[model samples]
Target: MTVTDQTAAVTTAPEIDSEQLRAVLEYYFDQDWTDGLPVMPVTESSLAAFLASTDRDPEEILFTIGHLNRSLSVRSAAINAALAGCKPEYFPVVLAAWEAIAKEPHPARGIWQSTTGTAPFLLVNGPVRTELEINSAGNIFGSGFRANATIGRAIRLGCINVFGLHPHKLDQATQGNPSKYTAVIGENEEQSPWPSFAVEHGYAEGDSVATMFVIRSVVHIEARHTMVPEQLALDFVNTITRSGALIHEYTSTLLVLVPEHAELFANAGWSKDDLRTFIFDNATRPRAELAAVGKDALSNRTRWRLPSDHPDSTPDTASTTDEPDTVRLLSHPSSVQIVVAGADNAGVSAVVEIFTLNPPREIPFSSSRIG
Candidate 1:
């Protein structure tokens, strides 16, 4: 069981009852050890229960966060999960999400410290979603769902405690969005016309999995009049075109569509690949437009350098009169991730862009089983 210097012995955390909880909460707040929310105290019983939910050893180190130089142990994860108000049954999903976070291509420290105020956007798939009662419908991205809220918060708390990406100190996000607190959504697979996100990502049909991505912004779209496939896809591409171009070597984008909106494509017999191809082809702007926005000579400057073959590697120097120089928004068709979620709101969708960097490489989207 390899561990980092920050690793603590597997000892029982101090207990705090309701009577003494407020004072402790105030103490943590005064120390700036919280995400501005009152946390559930990680008592001995809760910690034990969380640890019991997983089969791994409590002292076993899952991954060493490269940027932070911190080793995350199973015990530490369970402690934070208990603090985040997750049920014992939710522990597997929490651990799987952490594994996905560890597998990301970008370093965790850089992402949490970025000025864009990025945070992990989690998407759960398979029967575990229904078993945990995760929200995939109206106000799913908003409040009032425990499975959605705390599970996401657990990951943030783990980053703060185990990995030391504390907000306002190490985790500096200028004007962070509401998703920073919690951004977990389940695919409405039961109602979806297509396969589950897990299947598309190479998992078994019923396998429980969690997909994680470091998202900078989620652009919401409402195409109420899009009754046809082209209309709906064009609506998405229009929004993508208007968004800030952060084309990097690996630009992966997420399109979360409600079942109603997905139905339009299903009716047209279009596949997910078709949707990705359509968006990749149409989500473009003239080179002149990019130049007008001061992006003509922009280059990716991240540590994981992109190849020279990247479409945007060269300066967009097409002649102003040469057939309107066009630049595609997505690097490739596969870069577009299509997940059907939400209920009742037929035309509602969102485009979650990975944390944009100078060289355009953030954490690659990674998924792991919740087993």
Candidate 2:
């Protein structure tokens, strides 16, 4: 039989018993080939299943991981997906996510190498969410569900096994967050008052889309008391623009609002655009304060591409040390995106800040369609 990738094709497949499986796990650990978690063994059959799920050929070059100087193929990605315990049906979504991260726009290399311990935050939309049973309700980001756990694990394993981003090797994250384990969520489109996130991003209403954001941290905001849009808006503004907030010249932030909290804005006749505008207008930090925190020094000359503003018009404000002057945290209302997710019972939202090199660095958020 002809094999496409050596990683996926076992020249002489082993018929391993339970004892041999245990030995294989130990062997992978000894080689530091795991993400500190026991990976499901990758088998030839499992690899073939993943490849057959996708329309692409097994030998086709999927994408190249530049940091490790490795060219990833469909077969290799399938092996990593199998290693992460992904169901064969989930392979298409995995391939889409991998393709998104491989682009220069997404800066997968920087996110993997950064000291912020950033992990990719994946948000899936459309029928795929229900089909895959990805958690979009209470404890959506927590452990328990198989789809959420393994899908995220598959991506992490790709970074480890394919991209060679093991800790102390290429991944130099200091005090990395728990999201590095698995951070995947589906948009609660049923509960959302506005159009789904995928719809807003130019995809058809029912299209399956997967968006990847390089997240440095996830700050959960509890707004149980707030009933009005103004109150909730202020809470969001304060949270995203707090002192020591990681707002750089090119920061893109994601606000994942639970349905209950999102209702506050909808009740006030606030469209998604209106909510984004309200947050952008209010989220500001004193320029001197940012400079005091060494942000000004850390700022770069590269202009951040905000969805609302043209790149050329947004002047470089990295050196402005005006103490009394308030510097806007977001360049455009589009910089801070609002996605309705989570359960409706509680008023919990999340502020996911993207990873940046220093200040004034750009990290792209890429989306891919899943069939």
Q: Estimate each model's TM-score.
A: 0.86, 0.85
Instruction: Report, for all candidates in order, the number of backbone clashes.
Output: 4, 0
RMSD of 1: 8.8
lDDT of 1 at 116: 72
Candidate 2 lDDT over residue span 1-371, tens digit each? 34566645664566558788899999989877678999887778767888889789888877775655687788888887788888999999888887767653445345567777888878899999999998888888788888888888888887788778788888899888888888889999999999998898899987988888888878899888867888888987888876555535545678899998888888889999998888878877765665565453332244432222333334345335453366666667777777888888888899888753433224347788885
Per-residue error at 284 for model 2, in Å? 1.3
RMSD of each: 8.8, 8.5
Model 2 scores a TM of: 0.85
CA lDDT, every model vs. true structure: 0.77, 0.76
Question: Least lDDT summed over 10 consecutive residues: which range in candidate 2?
Answer: 299-308
